[model samples]
Target: MNLSKTELNDAELSRYSRQILLSEIDYAGQLTLAQSHAVIFGLGGLGSPASLYLAAAGIGKLTLVDFDTVDDSNLQRQIVHREANIGQAKVASAKSNLTQLNRLIEINCIEQKLSPEALEPLIAEADVVLDCSDNFATRFALNRACRAAQKTLISGAAIRWEGQLSTYDFRNPDSPCYQCLYPQDSGQELTCSQNGVLSPVVGMIGSMQAIEAIKALLGLPTLTGKLMLIDAYSMMIRTLNLKKDPECAHCSSALTERDPL
Candidate 1:
């Protein structure tokens, strides 16, 4: 793709000139980002920041999926929504905010919940998937969908001062999946509403999610097969090497059949 014609014009060149200066994300990388589409699973805390940055970064198209509506309580962390947006659909609010951020980008608001039946097609069309949902069921569903579709998935979670980030790419057979690190039967349950979360903690982690998504879209090195943990209270960051589980139901089951070992 011609960077000058397909990616940026004189107007866009003026808009994105600073980013175009980066050697790593020059005209070519910006073009890759501009042509790529990302699917964001939730529109709450993490989704709010992730969508904002991705749009500002010149990602060509973004599909925002969320069934919830904005509420007063969400204002603390969901920076995309405002006092006037309460009761409005989160996707709609997100689309409005994103458009204001970058008019050159296209934003599609899917005001519906994500389901297993609807997962494959969306995952297939996306260059990268961001998991910002607050619940395990949605997260697991996204993981399975990405794995089946062979799409790159960037997952993040934040509660209080703690946050976790990880990337899963099924294209690499050796990369560990979300289920590999946290088994479905591990029986751990947590929710933002119940556990409580800090607003900036979500911002910090969600921004990282956006970074990973951009890197994945540009075919740059990402957090594949690694977990990044953050503690806001102490302002500490830690990276942990993740291993593919031999018995990982999602990844291993397919490997066993293909290898027939």
Candidate 2:
């Protein structure tokens, strides 16, 4: 993956003027975003907001992966899919929405479930990875791939009235990967299909995922080692510090190899 930044045109600068005016993002940061490629795992509620915001923020390339078709049940929180797209592949539908937002950016649509062989190469080309998949299997696979590729991953989950957002900076030797926080075999999966989610709760978490992704791509401060919990019902937000586990099978070896002693 080329790490070279892209220059903005008059139209792009004008479109992102609001973001550029901010002290943190200015021109250089925006250019960095234009150079970055982000891979998103799911095209459901979380991926909808994350991908949309990333596109609007001017990411140079985006790879969207999903095998499912848009269903009416997803309309409650998955804003990217519309009534007209009920039977279309999610990646294709998402690409349509994202391209309409930013025609200059590149959108790679992968309308199939990624196998281990397929995932590694895609992750190797990304500047950052977002785990928005509903199942634990995909999340664990993504965590391993990101750790091996030394990429930062922004993970988000929402079900019922609660939501969670966090970043696992696997590029940092001391940082904890997702498996350090939740073991692969630890718990049964709980999805929005089984429970229920408020419409905006996912938007809230997915929006935060976008914010962290932009910051991570620009080399700015991010929520890389902290977990944020949201209670949309009570409107309470809490953040907890995260620590790397010495016993974590996936990332512990890297940390051990880097130990100075």
| Superposed model 2: Cα runs more than 4 Å off | 1-6, 254-261
Best by lDDT: 2
Model 1, span 1-261: residue lDDT tens: 123346467777787789889988899788888788899999999999999999989888899999999999999999988898899999998898788889998789888775677877788889899999988888888888788777899999999789999999777877788889889898977888888999999999999999999888777899898999999999999999998888888777555332110
- For model 2, residues 52-156, the per-residue Cα lDDT tens digits are 999998888999999999999999899988898999999999999889889988999998888877888898899999999998999988888888778999999
- lDDT of all predictions, in order shown? 0.86, 0.88
In TM-score terms, candidate 2 sits at 0.95
TM-score top scorer: 2
Q: How many residue pairs clash per model?
A: 1, 0
Residue runs of model 1 more than 4 Å from their true location after superposition? 1-5, 253-261
